[model samples]
Target: MRADRLVSLVLLLRQRGQLTADVLARELEVSTRTVLRDIEALSAAGVPVYAERGRHGGFSLLPGFRTELTGLNHDEALALLTAGSGRGERVFGLGSALASAMRKVVDALPESHLTAANDAAQRFLFDPETDLLSRRLDVEEVPKETMVEVRQAVLAGHKLRLRYASRGQAPRRCVVDPIGLVTVRDKGYLLATEAGTDRTFRMSRVLEAYELPEPAQRPDNVDLERVWAERCAQFLSEGHIAVQVRVNPARRDQLLDMAEAVRAETPDADGWLRLEVTFQDLWHAEWAMWQLDTDAESLAPPELRSALHQRARAVADRYRDRP
Candidate 1:
């Protein structure tokens, strides 16, 4: 702990050139007394650091002992020091980490811009959702530390023991060699190889993760990005549910203009539109059909189409009986 403070202190003094004890303690998360002890340690190690005691006095290295940080311009320095406060805390974990690192950058800033860095850090913020579709889904019940370790294992090319809960079953355990980590919106995925087969484990679905003694080995000649894309394609393809609908050319054109893909022959001569698209297992297809009304006609996929007609007929029958 003392060593950590000492190292951070040296780094601080070298980059900052001069800093008040109060400021160093605040940045280092230690007391002024602790910072003083650290300064003494640095001095003992012949670091050429010294302290001043008066009101305007603080710590500064002897002349010719100052070290400067590399390659940070004024705006860049300000941006780095306070880049996360504006983004409400739930965006990217790595972004949060970078924000913490930015504080260190602020500490390293030249005295002339210290005030600006402090001001910027307090005001800088970003929202990841502005560019992403935010959705909430069931995730595994694992601790953040466990997830961090699992991610590190994937990066380190290590095998992991995963206790996962399946969609409709109790928790099952499996051993997997992690190859990559994927962030699909709010979901976290660990792309791995199990028994020579590629598998993806969702982090939120994981109940437990254990690092195995087997050194992590990456798969040979495998392109993880390609594999992940293929998996996503397959997932989308599996959801293909056909729906046929009747809509006038005016409506069909409007739909097409809106980028909704139309399936089968588009002419529909009679103003009917046939379209098929992928949908998740959880769907409100019938309700959506009802909402679309006469503008949408379910043409193919006999089961859903027939059901739609029957429901319409039933509604008519109910009206007739009521009259």
Candidate 2:
């Protein structure tokens, strides 16, 4: 919820006129380092925030710059604030805008509820980088220049040229009529059409992108949710290799991360967990299972079991003698 934290930082400055980084950090429930970074982000976004160094000096906005948005109830403000932190500011290319809008939302609240609303919003966390077990979600990174180009084409209804890299494939050049962008679980996908056929490209794998001058050839109205659901359905119906596994409960998340789906689950007599999982193909299944090491054992699909056995033997043979 860095977005909402930024809003709170601005609100604190706006309320107190000027406050030192220590006070800002204390009030915002973050460190002084974080406060300084938020200040930089605000200034880069043209927020007119300025810092005065020395005793009795701190950060303040330029005179005559403030939002006049008001009349929002505490609950409404709370909802907006929660959304800001939940979706985060990185969606699409509007991180700055989201922070600015959330600031306005914070400012609109009655002074009595402003602090309470922000505190409440801070309670609900979503899609944080670290999970309960301290395992990190490897958030995908999309290049800024490439994302900007692809986002522009989608918004402007222009065709886009991309040096794209798909899974397990070499990067290649292609042009697609842009439809829209979709972000799920911190990963972004650019949904478009290549030669009148629907296509979805992971934004991270876009090595390079350029907004084309020509307009896109798209339907009159695009329902992104419907199109995405249909594509997901198509993928689900396609062939997948299903393998049953008994895995240590502790590494269950690691196993599920690489699986396409979980079809069944149960606990074994010895306290291990048994489950049926699907992978993209046999190779994928083998690779996924191998990553778990001894934490998982394949129970079905003779081909997968044989492949795992062969892989283990190959490794054993390589290290048959100590290095």
Candidate 3:
């Protein structure tokens, strides 16, 4: 850990040119005394670190010295910059580290390619609070402490005890053998097992988390992508409501994209495309169909159609009575 911290200190100085002990302490999550000691240690080890004494004075390396640690090219630097813009870092509690690393990456770039790469990177944006259609992005709330504990357990292969509150269900205590953590659409989940049964728990729903001292009982080499895929398949299959819908051909692609497990059937005689899709439940189906407005019609599971009708009628009644 000290070795890593020392390396990070060198890289930080190399990236920023000059920084005060206070700034270094804050960035490295250590004390000013520790920063001073590390600075002395770096100098003793022939790192050429020097300190300037004044309000604006700080620690700096000899002029024209670079760390030679990161060798990112133009495109690679831009890719790292773009990834740093994502929300995953915030969920994983690496926001500050990512910011510091990005600064180093930008500073490490060749001057000739720096400005152009930075400008080109501005063309791509990610996870804007509001999308093009004026719909707000969904950002799940996960407690920082909870996320940190869960992440530590998953990475260290330790057992985790969590007080989970599933929707519409009372909070329950469970001990899990964590396999990995996954983030999808800005939401985080822990792919784990309880009593040898597979379970996926949303980080948002974790009311409390504690890492156990015992090592987790999990596969030696787990494939997180494969596990996530299997979990998704199971989630879509269990207690899911299949809805048959007829959509205008022009809007067929939109409907399919919005719905899960979509299967295209022959177009109806009226030239509308028929599709069968599965939704997590009735409310899930209703919400999805609601987004299509009038472009798609739900045709099956009479209850779903009735639910939509009632919702539309309720909206119409509200406006009808307003006048």
TM for every model, in the order presented, reads 0.57, 0.73, 0.79
Q: Write one digit per residue (lDDT tens) for candidate 2, span 1-323.
A: 88777777777677669889998887666799999999999999888899898898899987656565557777887778788885477787676567667656666666667778878878888668787879787678887778889988888999999998888899999999998899987889999889998888988899999998999999868899999988776766679888999999999988998898888999999889999988999999999999999999999999999999999999999989875
What is candidate 3's CA lDDT for residue 273?
84
Whole-model alpha-carbon lDDT for candidate 1: 0.65
Ranking by TM-score: 3, 2, 1
Distance from true location, Cα of 142 in model 3, Å: 2.9
What is the per-residue lDDT of model 3 for residues 1-323, given as tens digits with 9 covering 90 to 100? Answer: 78778878887887778999999999888999999999988889999899899888999988776634346677886777778785646756666667766766765677656777778779988677775557676788888889889989988999999999998899999999999998876788999999999999988899999999999999899788989999988888888889999888887756665676774577798998888998878998999899888988999989999999999999998889553
- List the candidate 3 regions with Cα displacement exceeding 4 Å: 31-33, 43-59, 69-74, 100-116, 126-129, 247-273, 321-323
Using TM-score as the measure, which candidate wins?
3
lDDT of each candidate versus the true structure = 0.65, 0.85, 0.84
Best lDDT among the predictions, by candidate number:
2
Displacement of residue 251 (Cα, Å) in model 2 is 4.4
lDDT of 1 by residue, 1-323 (tens): 67656766766676667799989998787898888878888888998888787888888877655434656776877765544454423332354344345545655566667666666656655433332324333233447667767866766767898899866799998888888777654567788878887677777788888887787667555687898988776555564554555665545543443222334545566545555533333244566566567787756567777677888999998889552
| Model 3 weakest lDDT span, ten residues long | 64-73
